[model samples]
Target: MSSDQVKNEIRRFLKSDDKLALCLRGKWGVGKTYTWDALLAEAFGNDTVSPQKYAYVSLFGLETLSDVRKSVFEHTVGAASFRETKDLEATFSSISERVAQLASKWRAGIGIIRGVPVVADYGGLVEAGFLDVRDQIVCFDDLERMSDGLDLKDVLGLISFLKEKKRCKVVLLLNSDALKEQDADDFRVQLEKVIDINLEYDPTSAEAIEIAIPNRSTLRSRLVAEYATTLGITNLRTVFKSLRICERLEEVLKGYDERVISQAFHSACLFAFALYQPNDAPPLETILKNRPYSDLFGNKEEKTPEQIQHAELLRRYRFLKVDGLDLVVFNSIRTGVYADELIKREADLIAAQLDLNDKDAAFTKAWDIYHDSFDDNGEEFAQALKQSIAENAVAISPSNLSASIATLKQLGHGEGTNDIIAAYIGSRGEGKEFWVGDPILPRFNVEDPDVKAAFASKAAEFADNRTLEEVATSIVRQSGWDNSDLDYLDQKTAEDFYKAIKEAKGEQLRLLVYGLTYFRNVGNPDPRMSSITTKAIEALQRLGRESEINRLRVSKFGVEVPAA
Candidate 1:
């Protein structure tokens, strides 16, 4: 029912004294009881209004009809006297006053009913405190949670008695979805006979959100509602919890712009919904690639069942292509790493914005400053330098390259430092100028032998796949051989080239030797290349192959052969 219809029905139920019961049933957390209580508060001004009594009893663990009877009697008020009273105490006082008046009319030691002695059963009278629930609004909550031994027909029978005999306005607040299979079937069969009105407690989205997040004006609340609706989230508990997470995120992400904050909020909502709702979240890669979003909402032609499910999951959340969020955000949603990285990156950007000097390494330099300030042993400085170098190498920032190189000079022999340096140099063009001058490497370094061989073998493989000139050009560009700081790498490459020729099989050996001769003359003019050419000449001559030697001299190098 619409909120208006439900409201009108509840209003009618409260005002009318008809011998009928109203059943309010819904899925969990859709605010069924909340609505009912709101209505009660509206009608009575407070729960303890005079005379027209309100009783609430939860049948959650009631084991038998006796327990139900006791609960109703205890919860009910103003049963006997029709006069309005302030509280249960006033109602009990009115009953007690009537008893006193009757006691005054009787003799002190004798009581009679139909000329016989009347013995009062005090226990029974106390047990039956207030069963006459005339003019009372009684609610039986958590009906689905009622004990297994308390049969459904039995509970309905009690509701029937409250309406027929007690003349009370009864309401059954239940989550039918939670009902056990047999009980659910039996409840359907039995509720029909007893219930006068079945009002399925269908709360609207706005109503649900209002109940879940009372502070709807806040950005966190607004975003949660928007996201819940977009994702098509209808479960009030999940919505409430998701909004709570957003509230926490808002506090933590206070400094970021709304766009960034909203992104984080949205990501958090996706994660929360996936946890709370029924979904088999696809792998992070699938979401990261936009495949899931595409399969459901994009132009992707082929669709698998898993992809379809992923799409539907997003759709249920009202996620559409027009939302314009990056696919990577979904990845961030699934694994916290993405969001953490985003926050870190944003922090860095913000810090950079606030930094007075365009190049402030104040935080990074703090380590050095601390060591110098203490005049401590250089161990701390050395360790700091090592960390700075390693961090810079992996990230390879042009801004910090000079500082990193200076640190590397002190900690160059640290594990994997050489590889980092090699990779840094290897990434540049052989002729490209270093951002800092060649004195960058104070301690001359040897290229790792494994690195040298791999470079050579890879170059040879490239030669077989492409022209030798192209291979030479590519390696020279990549290895930064022209930079004097990296000349040793050129020499190492030449040596590795010689080893490759010796290990190469017949045709590959011929190609390796030829490629080396061309590299000597046409590639970087390092003397290492000249030495490698000399070695190739000697190796071919030792092979007693004049043809190969002359070919290296004329066909490749364009140099005249010295008489062998």
Candidate 2:
């Protein structure tokens, strides 16, 4: 079910008193939280009571078992009139009591169930009091931490109590990729009434490319391919996390609350556009969010030297070289000296050897090159291919000159093709070879069978339009994000807010807000650091100087801040 459908289902779930949970699943950059907020809005109209009718809590730092109990206790305290609430006990009894009273209320919205900062047996206090509230709905965005380590006790208890005890509607927003196989399966089983609302990132052909510079498309392709290698992930989930792609993108992505989650999706988009766009830039008021950068995104693979090399091959291109240096790839693992020299000499090499292969002898010559490149050295060829895959060093698609791989295949390389195929994916593009399409280095050989299959999967997803979810789980590694400080799009992410003020009438565009919030704590920030761009820093300086805009309080965007 879509976010809207899930919103509608709340009423049915409430009326039926079904104990099943509503899990909104997808990958990061895919917008599970955004979908949840949309659902929440559908369930509850615009009103301050959004906080009162429903409660919103993030199990972000839920470290120990106590953290789990504490989160539940703090989030649901005001709903009960049980034993004097004080630590975990206050939460337990209060929650138990709240469940008893849930059926009595019908209205709903998100609100903190506030009581004594220190737990006290606090009687239930619904903040806004149901205003035409029909059924209660509770929504959780980026619920990665709360559901981990700890058993089905607290969270399950909360779920169990809400449905079995309280009879209120519940929605758990999650990027499916963040969820491991076990966790996802468990969640699916628990939600019982699972509603799947998969979404895609890249819009249709109708979705015009907003920013167009001279080589902008080329730049983006290179950068994306570069980031693709950095994350060592071909899936979309890794796209957003790619520091090369977004550069502390999560800084503007502020949100734990439902509506805010929706906004963060736009923030992610804003960062992408801002980085790629030229000349015009977004204002700080329109760009930054009030929340801290967070890792609520679950497990992600850390970029390694190899992956970095992978990124380099995808983005950079060589024109010509000085000496005999092979600087064909830059901004990757094997850059600098030799790499830089290679890039500098590419054009010259091609020109100098322009007559290396004569088109007049095309078929025979091309055939000879193919065989000489791989024929006898089977193991060497396989190893070279494997290196290509791992290094993101292979770009294949027929041929470059008049002789393309397609023509060769037509002539039948057979097992020679199969051996080449095995080397591509498993090796992750290790060996550097010829160019085909897109200029990125170590490109996925579309001709390789395994690569063909992987590309097919990506194409299928693209066809299905679910790139957002695809990005979420793509970079995942052993352990997921812990103690997430997510700020789903705050004021800065509301591209719609300043669109009227700047360029057009209601042209929504999120700019970088507090662009360095995630990086501020560093004493000596890296000028050539992996993530920061000189351009982004300049944007921050301009935004930060505006007193009127920077003076805005954190609360406006529904976020908490450190004391000055």
Candidate 2 residues lying further than 4 Å off, grouped into runs, are 1-20, 38-52, 64-66, 72-136, 141-149, 175-189, 193-237, 241-564
* Error at 436, model 2, angstroms: 34
Each prediction's Cα RMSD?
13.8, 33.1
TM-score of 1: 0.56
| Model 1: worst 10 consecutive residues (lDDT sum) | 430-439
Q: Give the local distance difference test score of model 1.
A: 0.59
Q: Per-residue lDDT for 42 in model 2?
A: 42
The digit string of per-residue lDDT tens for model 1 on 100-212 reads: 43443443435542242222532243344544445667889998788878888888988888878877778999896888778888889988898889998777667777677
Stretches of candidate 1 off by over 4 Å are 46-51, 77-126, 279-290, 293-564
lDDT of 2 by residue, 1-564 (tens): 443454455444433434455655544443445434444444334332223345555666555545533444345422222222333123445554554354234223332433322223233333222222223445555566554566533565565555555545566666555666776677657655333222323221111111111133443333444333332332233343333323221232222232232222223333333333312223222233211122245535475765444334323322112122111221221222223333334434543343333322333433354477645644444334333323331332332211232443544433354444444434333221221123232332345444445433333332223221121122122112111111111212333222321332221212222222334344675432213323323333333344445324323332333333
